[model samples]
Target chain A: MIHDFLIYFLLIVLIYTIIVMSFNLAVGFTGLVNLGHMVFFGIGAYASALLALSGAPWYLAVPSSALIAALSGAIIAALTVRLKGDYFQIVTLGLVFIAVTLSRNWISLTRGALGLPGVPPIFKDSLHYMIFVMAVFALSVIFFYWLTNSGTGKIFQAIRDDETASSVLGKNTYFYKILSITISTFFAGLAGSLFVHYIKFVDPTIFDLEFFVLILSMLIAGGLASIQGSIAGVFTLGIFVELIRFIDRVPLLSTVLAQHPELIGASRTMVYSVIVIYLLIFRPRGIFGRVEV
Target chain B: MPSILPQLIINGLIAGSIYALAAAGFALVYYVLKFQYFSHGAIMSIAAYSFFAFLNLMGMNYLFSGALTVIISILATLLTNFLIYNPLRKRRATSNIKLIVSVVLLIFATALLQAIFGSSTKSITLGQNKVFDFGTFTITSIQLSIIIIAIIIFLALWFILKKTRLGKAMRALADNKEVAQVVGISPEKIYTYTFIIAGMVAAVGGILLGLEQNLYPRMGIPIIVKGFVSSVVGGLGSVPGSIIGGLFIGLAENIGVLYFPTGYKDIISFVIMLLFLLLRPQGILGVKARDS
Candidate 1:
């Protein structure tokens, strides 16, 4: 039973690692600060949930989810790509509000706030299923790591560092930005789809403020602009949250803090906030952070 | 049909006035700080709650409570800048780091307010709900007071910005921070004054909004968005632009409910904001090349 729980915990950590790495693609590599990155994840989860419920195969649902998110990313990029710095951040923030509003109000598709539950697992009651999911996640991480180290990755870094300089050097900064955003959102969607199947429940709240903060915390903690750092960051933070939940099961701690388990969740958030703050204060460059600014 | 249009317009104007007042402090901060202050929303909410607490618990009269709230808010605003923003600025933190810090502070402050206030909506029943009837229109006393207060505040702000030495220093700081420093003006002192002014104006707006509607812990969220949209739509650093943009949003939102569901009323402003960012990123009254 302990082993089973551990596997579940590790699986969750693995899934979040994928999600965080995908987010780092845009925020860390490109310095986009796309606050609405969770929209793609939420969209992917919703799309895959609906698709799977309608008898589509899991394999088909995953890629299709990425495709949908990529399309959305492209549209968003096209609309607000020209906005620089803080304006881009606010625009993305607005996108998050709009996405959540749509997810809540669009009753016909998202089932409103009721959420899509009982999503089918990938394989029937086998530990190997978890391994398979982990394998897929690992493969994607490798692919992303390779992608970020390639010539295209250097171009993205150049664009992020100085768009004007990159443009002066004959790089199409806008096109590269769009490409980076598209790729980032695509994997984020993929992770979302996988997450829905693993948890067997998906909701609009998954796209809310808490998730946004969590993704951001992971990216910041792991060291922005480093793929390996983001994965470590997500795993570390995800497991930390899970550990807090487990600790809440302890009779002594529970009795002392009897009135508020909400405090536990809040404490976890506070921990992340403190870590980010400490990082900013002590090592503003981050744990594995590469970019200077 | 014809008569109701006038009433709608009047209502829009009243609502728009509230937004304009709220956006003033936000605009001032943006103009001076050159970055978004997410905590502005929490501060507004805190001021509203403070006013409510004073009136309900301490038995203070409405006018006295308003003054107390404004004073407390200004002090808090000044302290927040000193404790949070100034330290970060002195370290020369990146804009993204500053933004994240602001957002974290917003969330933490919001949660703190929720813990203290228990997340309930607090209403101020001042017993001043009398309505005045004109030839073809009617208005509440509260609404009339809000309009008067907004005008008074706007004029005061205008006077301060135009005539006061501190206001001139603020303008110089806003124009060019490094240059202002070269001229021997301390950015820290100017920022402190700016924050105090912002807090005072926002608290006044919050008090009026609470009186007009009801005060809730979460009330500042929507107002913050509306104010930001208004600030952006008018021009980030332009006080007059924020007023015009805020009024435009108020009118558009009130009138938009006629065509769309009430649930999507907020979306109209956000969409307009998004469109503004896309098409004319400078805002309605902003200079074309402004970095906002």
Candidate 2:
């Protein structure tokens, strides 16, 4: 039972590692500060969950999650790629809020925030599911590592450092940016699908602003742009996020908390937000972050 | 069908007035510093909470709490700018870095507020709110006061911008910082004053919103988003443009309920924001040449 729980926790950490690593590709590597990247995650979760719930095979649902998310990411990139600085952030903010609204209001599609239930597990046995999740995690890490070493990776860094210089060097910066965002969001989708299947639940809250903050906290805390950092962030912050379930078990602080138990609900996010602020101020580069913005 | 136009119009104007107040504050900061002030939204919550504490905890009257909170909010905003943002600005950090810092401050403030105040929603004005009736539509006195006070503040700001020496200095700094400095206007001083004034207006907006709706830690994000959209959609640096943009958003969102579900009202503003960005990022009053 303990092993099963550990496996479940590790699977979650790995899934988020995939998601945040993808985020790092854009924010840390490509210099595209997409404030609305959660839209892709939402798309992945909704597409795969809906597909699986409607009796589509896992083979079709999972790939479609990646494909649909990537396509949507590409579309957003195409439309808003020209928006520089504040305008870019504003538009991305608009796009994602729209996605959230859709997820919330499209009751027939998303079940209207009440959340969907009884999502089928990929494998019946806990051990086999753990191995399956681990395989996917391995694949994601390998893919990101390969991406970091490829010529395209250098181009992405160049765009981040100086877009005009790279453009002057005859590199199609816009195309590379769109490509990076698409790839990043593809992995985000995969992560989202994994998340849904593991937890066996999906809801509009999955794409809420707090969820974005949680993922962002992980990316920043673990160190941006590095695979190791992504892993560290997912593991550490994922535990912090999951601690709400065991909030009562936390020692030393439990006495003060025993007085007002209602605070247990908001304490995790509160701590995460404070940590993010401190990290930004004191260690902007993060533990494993190689680049500074 | 019943004539819902008057009711909708009243709501729109009241909401728009509050948005305009906030947007105007936002524009004041953006015009000179040139970064989207991420903590601008939280200023409202800070003021609102302070207002609440002074009223309820300290046993102060509404007027005293309101004035005291506004002053406190302004000072806090100035402190943040002087301590955090100014040092970074001196280092010649990128706008992205400034943006991130502001965002962090915003998130931190919201979280800290929740931690200190607890998660429960708190209201400033106690008991049942009094509603005023027109011939066809009903409006609350508090809501009507928001519109009236908003118009008064707007005119006051316009007067300052048009006639006052400090406002002239501010405009000079915004127009061309180097030239303004050459003319002996201290950019740092202007920044300090602008942030304070911005905070004051934000406090007013906060008070209005708390009276209209309710107060909570996370209330600032959505309010801030609306203010930002209004500012950007109207014109980034233009003050009157913010008012127009705010009204437009308020009306559009209110009327959109006829076609869209109530939950999708904010969605409509976002769509409009996208349309404005793609088609006319300059906004209604913005100069085309300045857009790039």
Candidate 3:
């Protein structure tokens, strides 16, 4: 039982690491603060959930969900690319609200907050299937990591550093910005589909502001631009949150803190906030953040 | 048809007035600080909850409770500036860090409010819900009060901005922080005063909002979105533009709901904001340089 729990926890962390790494692509590489990153995640989950419920196979549903999320991300970027700096932030923030509303209210398609349940696990009958899933996720992460370290990665970094300078150098900066956002959204969506299948339930709450903040905190805390840093951050934070459950089990601590079992939950978030603040104050570059663009 | 239209206009003006009051406070901080005041919503929420707590628990009258809340909010605003903004300003924090800090403070303030208020809606009955028939239309007493208060606030702010020495210093600072400091305008003093005034205005707006809609912990979220939209539509950093933009948004949201579901009201404002950012990113009245 303990082994099963640890495996589940580790798998969840691995999935989120991919999501946060994708987020770092848009935020860290493009200098675009896509506050609505969860919108794509939700899109992926919803698409996969709907497909599986309608008797679609897992292989087809996953890629289709990713494509849909990528399309959505590209559309959002295209529509609001003219906005600069803070205005762009506000626009993305607004987009998140719109996305959440659609997810919650579009009852005909999304079931409107009743949520999608009974999603099929990717490999339900065997432990070997879990290993395969982990292998696939790891391979995708490795591929992206290598891609980001290549010449294209430098182009992305240049676009982030100075869009005008890059454009002046004939880089077609807008196309690259759109490209990076779409690619990021695609992987985020892929992760979302995997998550829904694993949990076998999906809800609008999964894509709310709190989750967005969690992903952001992970990305920032882990190290902004690096794939390895994001993975480390997600695992560290995810395991830390899971470990808080043990706080209530500790005999002495429980007796001293009897009046508030929920203190563990609250303090868990508080610790995350403090970590973010401390990181921002002491090392804005983040732990393992790349020094040179 | 004409008579009912006039009444709708009147109602829209009243709602717009409240928004203008809120947006002006928001605009002041944005103008001087060069970033959106994320915690302004929290200040509004805190003031509403604090006022409700005092009125219900301490047996204070409505007006007295409001005044006390205003005072407390100002103090809290000052403290927030000291704790959050002042240290960053001293360090010459990056714009990105400032933005992130604002969001962090917003989340922290929201959590703190939830911890205290327990996620429940709180309302204060001021006994001012009576409706007055004005010819072909009717208006509530509370609505009328909101309008009168909004106008009074706007006019007062106009006078201060146009005539007061401190207000001139504020405008100077907003225009060019370095230049203003070179000419001896203290950025710290101006920032403190800006936050205090913004907090007081937001508190009053919050009280008025509580009167209109029951006060819930998450009420500030939508208001902040709408307030930001209004500020952007009117042109960021422009005081009068904020008022006009806020009124236009109130009218559009209120009247636009007649054609579509009220849930889409926020979407309408958001779409307009997107269009503005795309076509006229500087906003209708904002200066070109302010786009940065």
Candidate 4:
């Protein structure tokens, strides 16, 4: 029983690791503060699910959904390149609101919050699925690690440090910013696809603020601009958040919570909010942050 | 369908006044501080809840409840600045860090409100409202008061900004912090004054919002988003711009429901904001573009 729990826990952590790594790429590495990264994840989840449910193969749906998300990212990046940092952040945040509204309102495609269930799993067996996810996680880590160390990665950092300086060096900073976001969003979309298949459900709640807050907390805790930090952040916060479930096991508190069950969810949110506030104020750079905000 | 046009316009104006009230205060803090003070929404929530408590829970009269609510909100705002923002400023935190902290405080405030209030919707039952009809359009007393109060506040704000010593200091600081400091303007003092005024203004907006809509812990999120859209549409840091932007968005959103589903109303403002951002990033007031 413990072994099964551990495997599932690791699988969930790996999925989040991919998402946070992609988030770090855009925000920490590229310095875009892309608040709408969740839109890519949601889009990818929906795209992958609809395709797979309509009889498409796993290999085809996953990458195709990722590419679709990347294409949307490229378009958004292009349209928003002229904006400065804060403006860009707000516009992207607006995209999240738009995505949620559409997912809820466009009942035909998204089913309007009822969610699409019965997604075909790539591996029915839990152990095999864990191995497959583990392989994907390893490949993602290696790819991101290599990409961030390459010459192009150096340019990404340079652009992040100072866009004007990068442009003065005859580099098209806009194109590079778009490229960074595109690559980051592609991975985010892939993680989303994997998540939906594993959970066997896709819903508008997938675009909830809680998920964004969770991903953001992980990114901040691990510190920015490092792949290892991304992984560490995800594992640390993922375990901490998951451990909230054990609160029910407490002797006296469980009885009190049993009388008012709503407090459970509210308490979790409060913990997240308080932790984020404390971290941002007291430790802005986080545990392994390479670049200072 | 006997042209619900006038009614929509009236509804739009009423909504615009509330939004303008919220956006104006938000724009003031953003102008002086040079960062998005997102906890403005939290202030609104706090004031609304306090007003609800004073009027409903404690059985106080309207005027007394409002006065007490404003005082409490100002205290809350100052406490937030003292506890969170002041420390960050002393440490020389960047704008991004400040913005993140503000966003987190908003979430924290929301969670706190939910924990206390039990996530149930509350209304500030002000008894029965008196309705005044003028041919095609009908206005409730509360709605009329909201518009009148908004106009009064804007005028008062204009007076303070244009005719007061503190306002001059604030403008000077916003124009150039170092130069203002050299001239002995005291940016920190100006920041305090800015928060005070922002708190008072947004608190009234909150009271009005509670009277108009059903109060929920998450009510602040949508209100803040609309105010934010107003801020951007009117130009990020411009005072008058936010007012115009608020009205414009209010009108557009209300009129948009004529053709599109009501669920898509927020989308209209968002799209307009995007268009304004991409094409006229300077906004309608043509404020000098900051930072490329």
Query: Considering every candidate listed, which one attains the maximal TM-score?
Result: 4
lDDT of each: 0.80, 0.82, 0.78, 0.88
Winner of 2 and 3 under DockQ: 2
List candidate 1 segments past 4 Å from native: A1-5, A124-129, A239-275, B1-3, B133-138, B288-292
Model 3 chain A, poorest ten-residue lDDT window? A261-270
Angstrom error of the Cα, residue A263, model 4: value is 1.6
Lowest summed lDDT across 10 adjacent residues in model 1 chain A is found at: A261-270
Return whichever of 2 and 4 wins on DockQ: 4
Query: For residues B127-218, what per-residue lDDT tens digits would candidate 4 score against the true structure?
Result: 77999989899999999999999899999998999899998998999999999999988778889999999999989999999989998987
TM-score of chain A of 4: 0.97
Predicted model with the maximum lDDT: 4
Q: What is the interface RMSD of each candidate, in Å?
A: 2.8, 3.2, 3.2, 2.0
Ranking by TM-score: 4, 3, 1, 2
Model 2, B130-202: lDDT tens per residue? Answer: 8877877898777778899889889988888789998999899988989999989999998888888888888
- By DockQ thresholds, what CAPRI class is model 1? acceptable
Score candidate 3 by DockQ. 0.35
**lDDT (Cα, tens digit) per residue for candidate 4, span A1-293:** 99999988998999999999999999898888898999999999999999999999999999999999999999999999668647888899889889988988899998888988988999889889889999999999999999999988888899888888999999999899999999999998999999988998998888876678778878988998988999999998888888877766678978987888888787777777777777777887778998865
- Chain A TM-scores of all predicted models: 0.92, 0.94, 0.92, 0.97
**Best of the two (2, 4) by lDDT:** 4
